[model samples]
Target: MAGSHGGSLKSWLAVIVILAGFTVGGVALCFGPNWPLVWAGAGIIAVGGVIALLVDIFSDVIVDAPRVLASEKVDRKG
Candidate 1:
């Protein structure tokens, strides 16, 4: 679905990876403040960030032109 208002599969995958990292970190903290696991989670998040950059996720973004309403039109009568 090119030009659709949604991210590509790769972008979605990266987002999922980042979310998983947050979950892992949260779980580790709730358990016993497991430093090792926490670090691992951070690493996972970093990897996801790298993936996002590599894929140029922002390149897929589409910005619509600004709309001009009829009521906002200026009168040129002098």
Candidate 2:
């Protein structure tokens, strides 16, 4: 079954960015000043924003590209 995450490249990148942010946050909390909370919060927000941006870009590209769908099997999977 197609659970949740379809495993699109964009989704993977988003996951990577979020994980990186948490890793950085961990380091910051351990060594840096209290600003890590602010930094991490902002970083998470920024990552979410970029993911949205990429979705927009992907949708634009999909729309602009030439394609014809005849059935559910022919639809864009990602």
Candidate 3:
């Protein structure tokens, strides 16, 4: 239950890798027009995607049942 809402560590790592790639690409654009670094960033993002697939991150996701609020329950009773 502690980690029910959060995904696995591996999935988190994959997301971090992808975010790092975005940061790299952003830095490249901010400083001069560094096409090579942009490409490198794209590669990093691709690697992250591959890692996510390899770890089967989708399988770790789950749909939780919708909670019934107390107010809603009272309204239904009336």
Candidate 4:
């Protein structure tokens, strides 16, 4: 059961969110108090977004069409 830390990931996520909020909150509380770490958060979010965009773009290569059998249809009049 050493590696079976069930729900630990959820707990860690909760802690990270809380800490992030507090960090921005503290920045606002000590600084102008209006735009507390907003820029920093936006920048971090943008970085992740850019990576996702690049990955998605790179994976979207042109796909080939499926082959159809010759007997499927025929133009007898032609």
lDDT (Cα, tens digit) per residue for candidate 1, span 1-78: 654568689988888999999999899999999989999999999999999999898886655566676777677998
| TM-score per model over all chains | 0.73, 0.45, 0.80, 0.35
lDDT of 2 by residue, 1-78 (tens): 133324566655766776777777776777755685759756885886698577653443222334577765556778
Judged by lDDT against the true structure, how good is candidate 2? 0.63
Indicate whether candidate 1 or candidate 2 has the larger lDDT.
1
Poorly placed runs, candidate 1 (over 4 Å): 2-4, 64-78
Give Cα-based local distance difference scores for all models: 0.86, 0.63, 0.87, 0.53
Ranking 2 against 4 by lDDT, winner:
2
Error of 2 at 33 (Å): 3.4
Model 4 lDDT tens row, 1-78: 133423344344444554565666567667775663766655554554554454453443444556676776656995
- Please give me the total number of clashing residue pairs in predicted model 4: 0
> Which pairs of residues have clashing backbones in candidate 3?
none
Residue 4, model 3: lDDT of 59
- List RMSD in Å for every model shown: 5.2, 11.7, 4.2, 13.4
Residue-level lDDT for 41 in candidate 1: 92
Model 3, 36-61: lDDT tens per residue?
Answer: 99999999999999999999988877
Predicted candidate 4: what Cα RMSD to the true structure?
13.4
| Candidate 3 displacement at residue 77 in angstroms | 24
